[model samples]
Target: MIEIEGLSMDRDGVRVLDDVSLQIPDRSLTMLIGPNGAGKSTLLGLIARLLRPSAGHVRVDGLDVFRAASDAVARKLAILRQENHILPQLTVEELVGFGRYPHSRGRLAAEDRRQIADALHRANIAALAGRRLFELSGGQRQRAFLAMVLAQDTPYLLLDEPLNNLDPRQAISMMQVLRRAVTDLGKSIVMVVHDVNCASFYGDRIVAMNAGRLVAMGSPKDIVVPSTLRMIYGVDMSVHEVGGARIVQPFS
Candidate 1:
């Protein structure tokens, strides 16, 4: 379980996160949704230990995130940020191999190779393994980054707006991949998403944040209602059930 107590962050004297306390359970796919500057990315960064919280403590499975060794934390959780900067000349295989650094240190053993292959297969990027990073399109690059995170083989995966560059087809595929990871592999996946419909469709639990605070959190059925949508986004929309799934239509 991931626990945050009195979580708050300050940047240049501006409060990015308020006194927020939330308990995110394990073995579930949690979607974080909010408007711009709602602290969604900041919250993910804090949970991943990329940014230190000014006045709170973050714990993953009872281990204090800041107090634990970096290696220990890396083994438990892996993050895929929005921006990635690496040697453009590196092949996809090489980039994926870096994910095993926490386990292989420098030299990849037999098990490391097997894991790399599995990650590549999981992300549907095996055929492009020999291609350089710059050779792939934006969506493919996103999948490569996801493959790298999967290669890390951590129990918790944190993704920040992973669907930004994806087309509709690629976006659906990515969501299915994450769903498989949660259902088949039992990995805990947390992601920040902008599309409310996608979040409503795929998330086991939807967490809505606004103005640096958590406005609502519940199952898809609970969060996809008209009142909840208005409360979180200040927008009026109609919700319809299609084959047992709730879909929000914002425009008439």
Candidate 2:
């Protein structure tokens, strides 16, 4: 389990993240949903130790994320932020190989090779392994980056808006891949997504935040209702049950 105790952040004298706390369970996909500037990504950064909070602590499986060794945290968790500025000339395989650095220390062993292969296969991008990133489509590049995160072979994975620039079909495919990762590989995944329908469909739990504060946290059925959607997004949306999953319909 991951425990976030009294986490807060300030940027240029403005509070970007208020005093917030949350507990993420193991082996489940939790979707963090909120409007732009709600501090969803900020919270993810804090948990991954990419950014230090003003005051509070993040503990993952009893390891103090802030004070632990960098390699130790890298071994325990992997994070993929939305924006990646890798050299476009790098081959997908080479990009994925970087994930093993913490364990391999720049020299990949047999286990590292196996992990990279497994990640490529699981991401359904084995065919693109040797292809340079510039030759791929937006969706393919996203998958390549995801493969890198998977290759890290961490128990916990955090992704920020992995579907950012993809088309609808691509987004669905990405969600399917994430579902498989959770069920087939038993990874605890926390993703920041804006599409509430996708969240309702794919998330085992939905955690809603607004203005840097947690507004609600529960199963899809509990958090995807009209009332909660209104409170979180300030838009009155109608929610229905379709195919045993809650679906939200936005009003114009």
Candidate 3:
């Protein structure tokens, strides 16, 4: 389990994250949802130790995430950020191979090769393994990056707006892939997503934030209610049950 206490962050005197405390359980997909500037990404970064909190403690699996060795943290979790400065010349396979750096140390062994192959397959990008990143579409590139993170084989994965630049079909595909990662691969995922309906259908839990604080966190049933949607997004939404999943329909 991941435990957080009194977490806060301030940048240039603007408190982007307030005193937030929550526990994120393991082996499930947790979706972070909120309006822009709600600090969803900030919390994700803090958990990955990419951004240090002004105050608080984060412990993952009983290890201090903020104080642990960098290598140890890398091994324990992997985070895919919003922007990446990638060498566009690198092939998809090469990009995925980078995830093994924690285990391979720049030289890939047979086991590393096996992992790379598995990640490519899991990400549904094996056929594109030989293709350079610059040659793929935005959605394909996103999956390539996901494959890299998967190749790391960490128990925890954090993603920021991972559905960026994808069509509806592609986004659903990505969610399906992520769900499998949680169930089949035994990964615990926390992702910042704008699509509440997608979160409702796929997330094991939904974490809602607003103005830099957590407004609510619970199963879709707890959060997909009209009142909760109003509190988080300040919008009128009617939630419906479709095929056993609650779908949030927003209208003025």
Q: TM-score of each candidate?
A: 0.96, 0.95, 0.95
Q: How much lDDT does each candidate structure score?
A: 0.91, 0.91, 0.91
Regions of model 3 farther than 4 Å from truth: none
- List residue ranges in candidate 1 displaced over 4 A: none
Residue 127, candidate 3: alpha-carbon lDDT? 91
Predicted candidate 3 versus true structure: per-residue lDDT over 40-94, tens digit per residue: 8899899899999999999988889999999999999999988878999999999
Q: Which regions of candidate 2 are displaced past 4 Å?
A: none
Model 1 reaches what TM-score against the true structure?
0.96
Lowest-lDDT window of 10 residues in candidate 3? 165-174
- How many clashes show up in model 1? 0
The alpha-carbon deviation from the true structure for residue 79 of candidate 2, after best TM-score superposition, in angstroms, is: 0.4
Q: Which of the numbered candidates is closest to the native, going by highest TM-score? A: 1
Instruction: List, residue by residue over 83-134, the lDDT tens digit for candidate 1.
Output: 8998989999999999999999979999999999998987778999999999
lDDT (0-100) at residue 61 of candidate 1?
A: 86
**What's the lDDT of the predicted structure labeled candidate 2?**
0.91
